[model samples]
Every structure is written in structure tokens, then in C-alpha cells.
Target: MKLRPLLITASRWKQIQQPLYPWVVTVDRIMRHERLGNMPGPLVHLFSDYGGAHKESLYETTAVLYMDVDNSMPWQVERLRVRQHFLPDGRRMSFKGLNDVKKQQALIPFLQASDSIPGVLLVAAVHKSIKNLCWSKDVRPDWPSDRAMRHKWSPRTFERALHVSHLAGLMVGGLSNPGQEVFWFSDEDELFANPTASNDVGNLFTMFTSVYANHPFKQIGLGTTAIDEGDRYEEDHVALADLAAGSAADMLTELAKYAGHIPTKVAIEFPGEFSRKTEIITSWLGYSGGNLKKVMVVLEPQGKTGFSVMRLNW
Candidate 1:
């Protein structure tokens, strides 16, 4: 993956030091789970192809769900492929590779099965209208370096969404385990080449380090980090993460229906065809206030806003 690097001159760094946004409204209690343990598997991976973008196109909202599973065999349902379908009414999604329904079927059962696996946690983060975000710009006036990197791969929308998704994953891992080591998606060759300045892997390491320096939330410790190349089909943990994210995306679409807006304008709206599946998924994740509990917390500019988080019992 060829990526443009963020080369910052000394003067540019000085400009970025100025506070663009003075105060931020952040969610206090995000990673609700307290009993986090050190395990060896993919720390956090995202899935966003589930067609859950927000309305108006001012900002596209994407939900990323990460899970850490105990070292074990992959889930039996890893082979299931949830394909997208189109019709006159709207869009429909279902599990392919088997003809149990031959039509659109509820994916909640698969989602529930994935969540039921032992030693698994489902942490969610939603990026809204990622393009409008301040951090999405590839070249800012403050940091006037043409070669400066913009998020991960694609620029504009994709870069912003990736940044938020990554932050969500990091917030979950950093807050949960404190000094726990996280495995980012990367390859050995790329890691060896850049180590600390690579696009996704190395940049993620640096972000984790920076967060550790100015730690917030609850947990405390000097966090550790690493990287990996996530293959959805072969890797069990990656597959699970994908399913979790996809599940959350589906749920978000369902929630939008009640809000008078449906994501992707899918013909088969949530609970429209899979009411039973919707019920099961809702019960598992539960509701945070009246919302579906997909997003725990959000940080944004003063005027602009994001998701809300539930109050922490702690």
C-alpha cells in the first residue's frame, strides 16, 4: 500500500500547537467493561462496507466495532458471507453461501453467535460526516506541508472516517487495559521499513504513545502497541471483528428508521424483514438512554456535535 507521508517542518509543528478548538465535550465513561484481561489476538479491527452512511451527505456516519477474542479456533460461521441485494423497494442484506432463506434473512443470529464466543468484547465507535472533521484535511494552513499525510489510504472522506474509527478502537483498548499491547493491521516488511512513521501501523503506534503520555479516561499505565496484516477470511479474530462492526452498522441503520432517516435507503429496513433478529440484537446490546447504544461518546468542535455517551456507574 503506497501512502503519502506526513512531513512536518519545525515551523509547521509550532503553528499546530496553537489551540484551534479551546474546549471539547467528551464522553466520560466510554469503555464500560472493567474486568479487562491481557490476551493475544487482533487488538481491534473495523468493518464499514455495511452501507450505514448517514443522511444529507454533509457527514457520513460510520460505526466501527472491535473485539478481542481468546486464542482459539475461528468461529464456525466465519465462512458465512453477508452479501448486499437490491430491489424496487430498497436494499436487502443477507448471509450467502447457504440457501436457508433464499431471500433476505436477519443477520442478528450470526451477530449474536459471534458475540457469544467466550472472552469477547464488543466496543463501538461511530464517525459522523467524517469529511467535515478538522483532522481530515490533508494539508492545513497551520501545517502547510504538501507532502503531509492525510489519514490512511484515501483522502477527504475516507481519511477522516479512518481516523475516527482508529481513535474509537484505541480509546477502547487504551482505556480498557491501560498498558496492554495492541496489534494493529500491518505487515512485517512495512513495519521493518518505517517502524515508527509508517502510514497506518506506525502512525497508530505513535498515536497510542501520545495518548499514553497525556492519558485520560479511567485506566492508567504506559500502553504498548504493535501491528498486523488483517485477512478477513483466513483470520478468525479479524473475521469476528468484521462481523461485530457490520452488526453495529446494521443496527445503526435500523435506528435511523425510527429517526425518520434510513441509511443507504435500503429497501429492507431494519426489523422490516428481520424483526425477530432486531429484537435479539437490541436485547444483547441494550439501549443507552433512548438511543441504540451504538456510540458511547463523541468529541467535536464547539458548534459541531457528535454522539452522546451514557453516564458511568463508576
Candidate 2:
């Protein structure tokens, strides 16, 4: 994409030197390499979903998928075909909902088809141990004392911040176009429990990119929808991100058990027998080509106060 790189100011550069620095660098590299020379349409659509919030897992994941299509009809048509073949009863497709091995295998070809959809999938997996660190004050210094104190005690608050930060990071790194508008759709969660919270999230996103990325969208719009009541077109995109996030969490959780120690970087390999969900995601990632690209980054604790970022390769 003939996009301009974000101009990080001296002050922003200081913040970038924090724990999330490695992740930002990784994202920039992936975006520049994969999206170079690809012109985006007038509008860019970003669909997002998150997973691995439970305390049992070692990481929480946020997945964002962006496409530069002026017309979404092609994507909708393929979504309908996949739904008719796999779920004709109006049931929604989800990562956790795919149970039967044969059905998962059957769905692989459709997901792997080059004509299915055109977009780039970005997944951010953050270690749960990050909650113990006190870096939010540096990340968002404008927060009032009461809010900052709450974040210090509330894991959910910390998670919401991480989610927004990663979303903003991906947008600045991957989807930077001068006059191109952005429409972001996210699955309903505690992050957007009410209209006021939703607006706050939107404002935070805009402010984040403006201050840290030194790039802001011409017009940024945000929407939230429940999984059961959402429009099919929106749901399909969100479901793709949901699958990716959940699959990454599953694989990383298993990998954590096997690694036992944090290495500087570790290439991702399925260390054990794959579940139906992992198998489907693995097949999809392995076969992704032609206008569709996928990248996964994991941020794990490096020391008492630092983090290491590693790109996960299939």
C-alpha cells in the first residue's frame, strides 16, 4: 500500500520504549512487508473479537481483521454458501461451536479457498502476568487518579486497556491511509457495555493513534453488535477473528505447558494432538494466500518488568 509510515515524535518514542515496544515493532514489520504497494479502497473495514479471558489460561488474545473492499457483497455471498453447507439452521458459526471433527474437516476447504475473502488477520496474545505490572500510568497518563487506581486493582480494566491499545496499534501499523475512512465493528463485551462506554472506547482509540502513532483517520466510526442479533455480514467477519483468537490462545496455552521457561523467541509448532478447532485454524493459516494474510504475535513476560514479543509461525 502506498501508505506513509507513522512519524513517531520524540515524546511518543519514549513511550514506545516500554513493555509493548517489541509488539509495536513486530506489527510495523509485518504491515510494511505484507501490505506494501497494495492500495486500499476508499473505506477500510475492521472487525474484531477477543478470547482467553478466563483465569485458567496463560494469555488473553485479541484478533482484528481488516479488508479494503469497496463492496462487501462478495464476502457476504461466500459466508452464505459456507453457512448453507455447514449450518443451514440459522446457527451462528463460532470457534467454540465447531465440535464435530468431520464437520471441521469439511469446513476447511471453504476457509482455505482463495476466493473466500480478502483481508489481513492480526492476532495479539498477551500474557496474563502483565496485569501484575504497573505500566498503565505510563501508557495513559491522562487518566484521573481514581480511574488509574481502579485499573491497578481490576484485571478486567487492565484487559480492556490492552485490548484497546492492541487494536489501535494494529490500525496505525497496518491500515494507514490519508483520506481513507475506517469503520470498526466489535463483538459486544464488557468493553462496550453501554453507549457511553462505547463512545469512550472510540475516543480512546482516536486519541491513542493520534498521540502514539502520529496518524489519525479522516473519519472513524465504531459499532457493536451481539453475536445472536448481529447482521450476518458483520457476524461473519467477527467470527473469523473470534476463531483466530481462540485458536491462538489454545495453541499458546499448550505451548506454555511444554516450554516451561520463557525464551527470547520461539517458533510456534503444534506440540501435541490438535483439537478439531486448532486443526481447522491451522489448516486455514497454512493455506492462506492471495490477498489474505495472517500474522500472530505473542507478548510474554521477559523479566520482572519487561516483555518479549515473538511472532508465531505455523
Return the top candidate by TM-score: 2
Tell me the lDDT of candidate 2.
0.62
TM-score of each: 0.46, 0.78
Model 1 stretches astray by more than 4 angstroms: 1-25, 32-131, 134-147, 150-154, 161-165, 172-181, 186-201, 213-234, 261-314
For residues 1-314, could you state the per-residue lDDT of candidate 2 as single tens digits? 01122333221111232224335665555444443324357787778888787776788888887777675456667667776776665565578777755446445644654234556777888888776332465555645453322212245665465565456545544455667787778888766766666666676566555544445567877786553363466777777888888887877777777776334543444347667677668567655455567767678788798786665665
RMSD of each: 12.9, 6.3
Q: What shift in Å separates residue 285 of candidate 1 from its native position after superposition?
A: 4.2
Error of 2 at 173 (Å): 5.2
Which pairs clash in the backbone of model 1? 6-149, 59-129, 60-129, 90-267, 91-266, 91-267, 184-228, 186-228
**Model 2, runs deviating above 4 Å:** 1-23, 35-39, 71-73, 100-106, 113-116, 132-135, 140-155, 212-218, 226-231, 265-271
Determine which window of 10 residues in candidate 2 has minimal summed lDDT. Answer: 10-19
lDDT accuracy of residue 314 in candidate 1: 7
**Model 1, 238: alpha-carbon shift in Å?**
2.5
Best by lDDT: 2
Considering only N, C-alpha and C atoms within 3 Å, which residue pairs clash in candidate 2?
Answer: 1-35, 1-36, 1-37, 1-38
Assess each prediction's global lDDT (C-alpha) against the native.
Answer: 0.34, 0.62
